[model samples]
Target chain A: MDNPNLGGEPGSLSPGITVLIPAYNEAESISDTVNSLLAQTVQPAAIIVVDDCSTDGTAEVARAAGATVVRPPKNTGSKAGAQNFALPLVETVWTMAIDADTTLAFDAVEKLMVALDEKEVAAASGFVVPRYVRTVWERGRYVEYLFAFSFLKPVQDFFGKPLIASGCFSAYRTDALRALGGWSNRTMTEDIDLTWRFYFAGWQVRFVPDAVSYPIEPHDFKFMRKQLRRWSHGFVQNVRLHWRRVLAVPTLRMIVAVAAWDAMVASLALVVLLPLMIVLFSAPILMVAYVADLPVVLAPILLGAIRRRETARALASIPGFLVLRAVNAFFLLEAIWSELIVGRPLRLYEKGH
Target chain B: MGIPVITAISVIFYILMALTILPILRAVQAIRRSPRGAGRPHVFPLPVLAFLMLIGIVGGAWVVATLAVYRLAEVVPNVRGLLPADGAEFVLLGIGAVSMVGTLILVLSAVEVLSWFCAEREPKHARGPDGQKVRPTDLIQGGVHSGRPHG
Candidate 1:
């Protein structure tokens, strides 16, 4: 095969990393994303952009910025579909999925590649911090990522499983990805679907904190709703889909159980019970339960901020976090009701940001 | 508040923090010893210690309140007959019941989701990303082809 997408001969690329950017109408941000990959400490074998029939000249911009562009005959409808279109062309040993709106730290690829040195690791994901943190939604996600990546994720990793190797910037062994048939579109979040599948197959996925990627998060309520709805439904759908196989994986089972409990019970406590108590018991103090976990949440945020020297920025974002948490609780409850009770699952792949 | 009441609350706060944060410290030690984590600078940060303490305090308070309620119920003649004799045993029983219920829900949901998966069959003409029709074997074999709409 000519393998024109790659430089030199196919499979001859050293370090063996082929980057896949599944894009649709991402001309505005696609150049920066591709440029970031080009400037990596460990240059990728090829940066292939699967232009999912974007009318905005996304393919042109990416091609201009040194990426090999391929367009699908039709709009693939989801990121997974677009990636799958480009999967067969990956001649390198490792296949990485990077969101069109995300950029990586200069050494991000270098850091993440270390974990793939371990044969057991089928896929590895880096730490993700929002690229811009000015808007309320962005700020809220900034704090949320800091807390999750710093605290919960490490514990999960220590137990030999990190929940989901985040979708935005994760690398997988090409063989592993092909054997599993690429990312699945059956669930709202293909990344979670793929990660759980990896677990069931007895393959390991890793979380590399040193390797960091910055993804542009939803900056306003309009975009946040699209992102949160998909995420909430994705989570519930995965639990329903993988609950059987999950029972055999000890760490994963415990993680899912606690997550489900918290998602269902804690959301009820915050969204419904808290308001009901305040109204019926005439005890406004019960509202304190809404922000009771703030101190604990802040602990991880502060640590993550201190490492990045953004303590003040993190502290200023605390209010945003609280607001986002409340909003998250409501969406989770809605998703549970919609998927489990109403039997209506979200099937559209709307752009999150 | 009276000085005594303020002092008592402070004391309880510290106790809760201690109980919760202590286990985290132990976990950190184990992580530091692991081959992958040895000498990692941020293994045990102060915020984690502080956060765990806060969680401990909140969780401990809940446990304490539950035990207190049990004690209160025992003193009431009407409710006294309802709870088991030992307050500790009663709390354990409550915990076991909740766990059992949660487990049952998980198992039932798993069965439901699996049945749905089993019954789900793609239409004869559904084309996958590569322009090939998705097969039923692909579904059971983990991930060869996915025909559903993406989210």
Candidate 2:
């Protein structure tokens, strides 16, 4: 590994923030990720890349691109563990974590810094759209992000609970993070686990809409399946782990309840009842229930797309979103069955994108 | 999330559809095709209008089925006795149930749309260290930054 010398521009390093990138065989993409951070308007005090025992030369690439590269003695197993390995070295006031494949807008860090201006905010996350939109899976995720970040997240932020500070790109106050013992690998998703812990600890997390990052999404079904499986298990695992603590937080409890309803009950209705009713009543028209909410769903999606000036893209992605929704329902049910009913859990962390 | 005004409008639209089923469908298509003022917002795009037409067609079919059931109940004394309420009451009751369910599912989005109108400001937290104040030399000595490449 190269020395921790400033590698991009000589004077790009600013004080108060250190960025951490956990890489595992990300040689192809780490340079762009590192350079994106180096190009930030409010530069990080240091950029540390935890190469996490990649067989590929991820360390060399990341180091060459201006990040101080460190390799764990062995694989950390999960992204959470890799991030935890480097967490102790973050000495700045703020510690940011970005995926090795993600790139930020020039002002992303600067805008996220605004959220931390509030003393109560323990962490902040930004809007995320997939870096590519060509694939069906990617287009589905793109629409999902636009709707979620533009609509759902803003409301959650307004209510002082933005569900989860997204893992792909987020910043945290160093002290607050250390106090919580860094990101937890107890669940499939370390970011949400940490965010919920912050809530339980009486801290706040903000969603800064202006701070945007783009990460490469899974372009094929195999990768999408892996990503979806992890995410599905992660949500169920977090709910089980934090149900008690969540109940103590009013808005958070409601949010979790609603999400559970959608994931479990509503999904069941869509998968089971729709088919059953159609067969029983011989009423094919009942199929409209599958898309009855289109009127309501389209309103927010169109509005969100209009804001991004991607109305055509959003419209074209609708079919992809529908297909993804069906796939998502199946995965959620599988997760519930496996985790809750079958008493088995998904403990392995595999990167799909 | 709080229930927003759109949810109410959506519920009302459904009820209006049930009340004047087929006629309302034509009226909707007519209004969608009608030209508006130059400065007005294009609330319904072509795709959205098409979706509404699909919903309208299906919803109209359901309403026709309900009317057929109402007529059956009128002729059959046993069927009329089996029903808890009159045909009109029963149809409204079904709509009410659907509306309630829709509201439950859509409250999150409703509040989100509502939030667009109400801009809530983030409260400023206590001031932390000023990044501009700290020099690169200061950061280097903090043990994290190594200024030179290693041999």
Q: Write the per-residue lDDT of candidate 2 for residues B96-150, one digit (tens) a residue.
A: 3355356444754544444444534432432225423344454445522333443
* C-alpha RMSD of each candidate structure in angstroms: 11.8, 14.8
lDDT of each: 0.77, 0.74
lDDT of 2 by residue, A1-353 (tens): 11122122313323489899999999999999999998999989999999999988999999899999988899989998888888777767788999999999999999999879777888999999889999889989988888788767765765578899999999998777877778888889888899999998999998888899999999999999999999999999999988767766777876776787778876777777667866875545455456655544665577778978999999999888888888889899999999999999999998987
Residue A42 in model 1: lDDT: 97
The digit string of per-residue lDDT tens for model 1 on A1-353 reads 11223223433434589999999999999999999999999999999999999999999999999999999899999988898889888888899999999999999999899888887889999899999999888889999999898778877777778889999999998777776778888888999988988888889998888899999999999999999999999999998888777766766876776678768877777788668856875544344455544544566678779989999989888888888988999999999999999999988988888
TM-score of chain A for the candidates in order shown:
0.96, 0.94
| Candidate 2 vs. true structure, TM-score | 0.72
Q: Worst lDDT window (10 residues) for model 2 chain A?
A: A1-10
Docking class of 1: incorrect
The C-alpha stretches of model 1 lying farther than 4 A from their native spots are: A1-15, B1-10, B18-151
Q: What is the interface RMSD of each candidate, in Å?
A: 8.5, 12.1
